[model samples]
Target: MWLSRACLRLLIGSDVSEHEEAPLIWLIAGEPSGDLIGARLIEALNQQTGTRFRIAGIGGEAMASAGLKSYFPIADIAVMGLIEVIPKIPRIKRRMRETIAQIREDKPAMVVSIDVPGFCYDVWKGLRGSEIPLIHYVAPTVWAWRPDRAKKFAQELDHLMTLLPFEPPYFERVGLDCAFVGHPVLEGGADKGEGQRFREQYGIPPEDNAICVLPGSRSGELKRLGEVFRQAATTVAEKYPDAVFVFPTVSYLRVQVTELTKNWPGRTVVISSISEKFDAMQACDVAMAASGTVSLELAMARVPHIVAYRMNAFTVQIVKLLHGWNQNFVNLVNILLGREVVPEFIQEKCRGDLIGAYICKLLEDPATCEEQMRSVDSALAMLYPPNGLPSDAAASFVVALLGAQNQTNFDKR
Candidate 1:
């Protein structure tokens, strides 16, 4: 309701330069992970259009590095969960309006919303019934939770770009032009890290155990899981006095993570850069992380790991009520393989003592660790696009949209 169909039609029909070399691509990414995807997509789009295509929208550090001047900081709308997001609803709505108004003004060739479904879907709805092509990267989890959203996505979006292989059929059957464009974790350089180099740089002894502790990127995640993860890591550290706890965090959270872990018995290293985090993953004997994309990254690094996450109590109950009857896993690796390849401690079970016990088991059992890593290789292999890298495959789909858009009856109208 932010923009009327009448207003959108007027904007789309306005005079646009045919001779302009730089076709504008307004891309929106509402979190760090999506920002990474946005950055790589910018690179791939550059390969297709070079500096001839201008990229702009909301993004974080990574996309900014890829030459995007965002209208606002991604944090303005980066909030997650039902209860946590309620307080920020007004602010997020304001930002969403700002984004819609900008799109109305800029009239970019295509608008691509990456990942954040709530924010992105609203912006797309505002421009609903317009000639402007709407594309969404990372299809919403309709296959797992709300199956009806697949129909909604097909109705609202001009094209759909999915990460999981089995996802395309869900939307494509609904008449949405959905493509399985690979997953970001596959080409993210998670597997290319040099463990020895990381160890040498950090001045850690070769024989010592290095454990990577990732609470999460968002402040909310840190608030929820930080202390629990700290306790779990502490429990593990007690067993191995020489264990080096490596906290791989974003720049803003570096000081907070350091301040929180100052009193720990074992040596601690806080690293902010992505390369350092990946290298730390390689250097790590095991990782205890909040559940999300990091598990896939750990799998890529062949690191033995356990996933833990705690959400608002009310949200937990709602999610449990909403989940499919047979849906058993919170971790992606487990979900894809249709079995528990990695251990997951969620809700009440996401405790320090319980997670620590599992961490201890992984550390003590080398064969178990090897088996989990081997299991993930099959899961990880399925994430790659049949033709090329994830970003490239996504770019090809978008470029095709440009051609199709020109031929559409809506544009001619």
Candidate 2:
């Protein structure tokens, strides 16, 4: 009995030592949404176990707030698209090279590359020879368009953590380790019954119809879509004189949007912050938004919306060649329904008059809005994860993989 007790103590001590030996995680979140996910994961990991793992790398405000010491300014690395990146390619390449070199010097146990595949893929390629275990968050939409990129992604990362439930099977078929982390927005809870409150708070008249306009957070996006959005609002207002237009202004582009929409005839209101975004989405009868994650948010709010976006002719052409679909946003409803539940107007098609016409129809016809909402609900039903916080599930998977690697190293040593 004494010998058995001693053996148990020794085993427990070894486990403690193994826990202590857990490698510091280096996280790279290339954009705002990715940074938000990274931040939540960091917080969840800290709470899950008393493990003292140090976090460092490139990310935005959310990651910074969660105690990540960003090596490079995240704003500097926030370039998007193929043609758009050409001008800043040299600067991006230099920053990426520096980041890789720093990672080599630091020799982290693992690297977590968040979204922004254009930059993150390059980072992955640079570090491939270093034998560092990498976990990529938010698998790129190879399934949606570039099915060939799956093979390349399989070769690059040790594991791929996905936000959508449908993504794992596609990666798994290609022999890549992937796990669905559920949608972060779902984990954060839906804004229920807040629509009426939102309208009241914003002083939106209950009798008046409302149209929410989401131009986009990026300056380039706003620049390209602003005039079109304003024009669309004008068209809608002309059709429905009692309609109010609410623009959810992201912090950086508030001034620009205000200056651009100054002379608009309709009652235009620009709001900032997350609560305000939800309030605006809830209060509005219909939404005309840029093609991005915001479409998903509107869907979750059960708001009928039209997704519209415009870019430079070169960028549009390049995307057209690469991607099978010409849709601007990846709305779950659109994907599940296999038809546009929320109509998507891209590039040349994304005009003010067309958008105004669409909004007017959605508002005027109750059946159109109802049919779209039903499709959205069906799509939302498909997005559930098995258990726990999405971030927790992702972190747990990483922790388990790290443990296995540590055990293998210990055995070899």
Candidate 3:
């Protein structure tokens, strides 16, 4: 009987007295997107449990605003690309150890690792024998790159929360407990963006052809794909001489993206506000985007678009050697449909002329644009869940875990 009470106390912390030590949940989020998701999760937890938690972790401004006292800067760990990460290896390892040390000292009731799989995996391994329940918020792309990682996660993580509906099966087949919370993208406020407002603000003539280009939000992504996109815009302008190019970037990257566009061939505009970015996307006739979550947003906006991407040459070589071109598509939309609903220009094939050619074709062919938009509708329908919000779904899982522990304590008494 005492054993169960002790276990419950340890699992939930000093929940009886708010003046006593408040319960803590340690979170680790490595990038911007993860930070956004983590912030929402914290809000959900507070709402569902009806108890304020002392949240601490490594995160960006969004999580901090949501009430996390981040122990360190998230940018220190928000690294990507295999070869690009080479120089930051030592720092990453040090931060991993620091994170592990903090988790040990804090002894959080639960440790939630969000999205930065490689760094999170190492931290998970470091806490191998600890009693703290390890919940990983985004499953690794085991279905895409390495199938073996699923078995390792099944053995390590106590629970896996996934964004995609089809993801649970991949992990569950390997004995991992999995839940498909709806994707965060679906929860984006549908009423926020106004395309006509953006066009009016910019004084873009109604007859002018506009193309929105999302190079990517990451600095590294901007560095690799910016020139390619710029070249493509020039090619696009050649076909439609009065074409206006819009580069909607995250605020931090706005100056850099703006500087890059200076060399562009025709009229260009750069916007940083997210709502304004979406508004610009809505206003454009067609978009050429670097493949990422933004591709999903463009689809939801009902825009006909082409997806393009470029990477460090060495990274491209490594990807080719390991995965090859086996996965028929890179754009999330095409991947979801299991076919090329949109044109994909990748690596050496991501030529400006070719990308421009596809954009022109899509603009000229109404049938093709209609067909792709229809696919977008089908993909979105598959993604939306019948129940509550994604954050609420994730919160329900955590709440259930807490409830089970509380019940165990009662049974022992």
Candidate 4:
């Protein structure tokens, strides 16, 4: 029976056998941002090795375009927040179990989990005893909100790949093996010209000083802050009649933002593409944005901006109860710099009038805008290594770890 099964497997040409020469890297990315990062890493891995590696797991269209074969629909797992995920727990668990079963049966060389801590951590836990090396891309916000999760993550992952420079030190302090991959944004050049062209393309007057408003990509976020953002823009328009408002809308939320801001009198443009987003950011004199990765992108673009965030009342209250930290993550970076380089407004303080007032101040005062831009330059300089070797350095680290493990196995044989 065993011989017959082996012969049948050989005759059928198993999918696993095709990948015998190169390692099978199982990549799981749970959001659009993570999917983009995973695609870049996939390209880097292929370039570094000069051999085609088989990538299989869950990722969206971007990763699929980069040669990743999905085990299940990636969008199914793209969930957020504790309260939002409760209804989908059973479905998520089923997916996790299926993933673990595949790992055990096929035995991939490495499991690379990117972002989505809640789901990926469960997958890691299920496959804890497997020989497969675990690599987690984009360290969780353990540094900020929950430091204790660091030790648990350290125990599970063989290596943690970080996008931020400050992340490695924090993970290392908790005894995790980690590497800082300079942000992908830096790898893509920052062109101020793109910003100007975007304004022109969007029919925004070149003479007008535009302020970009990015509420967030999520529907819930738009619903929460859309009215406030529109009101803020109206106030700014009143202060500076020449000021135009630009919104680099995520494709998914375009309709929502449009519906919300229909009554506003100011000229507003919503751009969806990556190129357009970069251009919009550059074209704007200042930005009023939600506190998220977009803020980092704006900073990298050298745009002076104000950051704000609004969450469910229940969630905010619970967070306040559990964490005694006075400031949210938006202002935390500025606080680390020892000055208010980027002003932050949150909760009730994130009113339209106040945000509008602050933005008006920044736009009118060239000195203030320059000061903020200087701080952005300083922050980016500190974040990246001297030679701009973040992508190459990170890829080398992952390849070396895999090589070392293979060598150890051969030695044992």
Candidate 5:
């Protein structure tokens, strides 16, 4: 996706040397998943405009690779859970100030903020009255919890770009300019894996007994599920001695995962590369994963999987108080399906014995595996939007906005 001066000439109808300044846009992504989406969006913008944008914001490795120099590490504000965020509040506030300061100094045409609503909301408030259009990618799940955020978001953000097909209506009902960009995973996200090659490279036997374990990307997730996942793997190994257990994680969390599995009682392997992680998902017979984006990935991969999630007790209480006990499914797949397409063990129910038994049944019984995978396939079918690629759609919106801004400036001149 390298940009050339020739392409720039064709796009802008002028030589790069003759141009005084390129359009600048600020993008902030507070999580690794958001970083991936932001990087893809940046690439889409570059491909559409022939590298006319100067990107500056907060993001991780992927956005950095996409040519954005983040003002600070995204990890500074990546914390989840109510109690977990308390200690980081001061630092988060400081970074928000620093980010607003940079935005004021740069005066970019627009600012796009990816998820992490708490941080992004504060940034929006900081930028209030500046007249910089603040566009938010990945709308909050108000249907699940904090439904009031939708109304507040309509007031704060100028535009909302959602990954889910059903999300636009919720924001639109509250008078927000919303677009349903297809989920990023649906657009060429499933072709990254080489399943057979991954099995051979990792010495995993080509059999129907391999399982993938994903504990999640958060430090709190590892702390909560580490031992339980290890014990579950042990149980699976006991039931099927030939069973292979694979765990894939990001590099930042590799050391924590490795330390968690150092004394594992069964045969297990932890892989850290992005390609290997996707390959493992494709290669596995069934996946036992934390309830998040990986569940959506497994659905996209058509891999049979079960999910589990646990949060701090205080945070759980807060959720119950805010959203109430009527909320059921935690996994995105199940929530989208409106049924238990995949079994979920959450909070106190997130136990190794129960999750292992379910895994064992799926591994031994082909019918069970087939049934679960079919449900996943059905739910995945609902995520596709009318547009072809979400990044392309999002980039088109940004480009049009930038062009309008240029026109306004020329008219003023």
Candidate 6:
């Protein structure tokens, strides 16, 4: 909150200097998904003010492409849940220390973190009571589970930028200044892909059942989901011999995903780049994806899809402890819809055959596919902000500290 006037006064005088350089912002993204968000936010920050930003922190290729000089590889903090994170605790702590030290030394204008709350919030907690105004993009899914974290996080955060329209209230109720800046998926260019071009490039027949396969971006995700998805794809191929499977994965994991799916009994294409990923999404008739952000992208693209996820047995138990035995939906589309608009197979029900059956149903039944699209359209409508792109809304929210304050701009957009 102090960053509003005091921090701005430190950089730009009250009259605003024409030649002064913009403030240095420290940004941290701990996964591929977060890397995308950070990259878009960086673009927004620079474009909204027509001033370049001095950036520092950690991210993957997307953020790097957007002019971020990452402190370390994004993979360093990609581990999830109790089972995956236990072995990397030492490395995580080391990285966190390095991050905190770098932030303190830089004395950046603001510290904004994208998702990856485990690492991002930890870094922020270390800087609590300091002058740096903390703004976190993409509110944690306390609404999904762990609702108590909403109040706990309010104590340390200066502001929170949420993607979901319903998320700001969770933190606002606890006394934190929170804003719903819209979902980045709205401006991610998912809906503009050329399906014909993608089909031509891959020589996929227009009549063939093309399925976009997203096994997730993290190493642990690829390891857990690869086998299950392969068997599932094989099942679909057995039923629809002309079906084509499109596997879109992170660049680092592309080769591994291709190798894993090589023997699946269909025409398989693995795509690495984001452009190709969106093109594949357009070309595909349906999708079988890991339970995460891609599910939201598929919904935005209006593709019929079923989501499936399998976590470490120990991690599954930990989630059960935190989430209780009632709510089971992990995919954001289903979670946002307040019902299973998309079929979900998670944990114990995450069998290859079961997922394959759902994929087959989505592929063959036009009614089922059309029905899902209708629901997807309804869900997508709620994600748009009042004006401009979601990132633009986020940009306006972020730069309010640098200029005259506008109370209506906080959440009205």
Give the local distance difference test score of model 3.
0.81
Encode model 2's per-residue lDDT on 54-153: one tens digit a residue: 7879988988888888998887788776677789888988999998998988898899998888788888899978999989998878766877778888
Across residues 68-115, which tens digit of lDDT does each residue of candidate 4 receive? 888888877887866888898888889888988887776877888888
| TM-score of candidate 5 on Cα atoms, chains taken together | 0.87
Q: Which pairs clash inside model 2?
A: none
- What is the TM-score of candidate 4? 0.88
The list of candidate 6 runs beyond 4 A from truth reads 1-14, 17-22, 52-61, 70-91, 312-314, 322-328, 404-413
Those runs of model 3 whose alpha carbons end farther than 4 Å from true positions after fitting are 1-23, 81-87, 189-191, 312-317, 323-326
Best by lDDT: 1
- State the lDDT of candidate 5 residue by residue for 1-413, as single tens digits: 12243543344433224547776789999988899999999998888777876888899999999999999999998888778889998998899999989999998879999988888898899898999999999988887777888999999888898988789999999999998777877764664677888888878888647888898888888888877777787888887888877888999898888888778766677889876778888888888989887888887777788888887789789878877654478887777888898889888988999888888888778898788778877777777656447887788777766666666766797
TM-score to native of every candidate shown: 0.85, 0.86, 0.88, 0.88, 0.87, 0.84
- Candidates arranged by TM-score, highest first: 4, 3, 5, 2, 1, 6
Please state the error at residue 166 of candidate 6 in Å: 1.2
lDDT of 3 by residue, 1-413 (tens): 01243443444553445565655789999998899999998887776555545688889998998888898899899988768789999999999999999999999878888998889989999998888889999887766776778898988899999888878998999888898877888767532567788889998888998898888888888887888888888778888988989888888898899899889988998889876777888888899988887888888888899888887789777877886544678777777789888788888888888888888888789999999999988887767545678887877676667656555655796
lDDT of 4: 0.75
Model 6: weakest 10-residue lDDT segment is: 402-411
Off by over 4 Å in 2: 1-22, 81-87, 188-193, 311-318, 322-330, 347-349
Give the clashing pairs for model 3: none
> What is the lDDT of every predicted structure here?
0.84, 0.79, 0.81, 0.75, 0.82, 0.81
lDDT of 1 by residue, 90-109 (tens): 99999999999899889888
Shift of residue 21 alpha carbon in model 5, Å: 3.2
TM-score for predicted model 1 compared with the true structure: 0.85
Q: How close is candidate 6 to the true structure, as a TM-score?
A: 0.84
The superposed Cα distance between candidate 1 and the true structure at residue 373, in angstroms, equals 1.6
RMSD of each: 6.3, 5.0, 4.6, 7.0, 3.9, 5.0
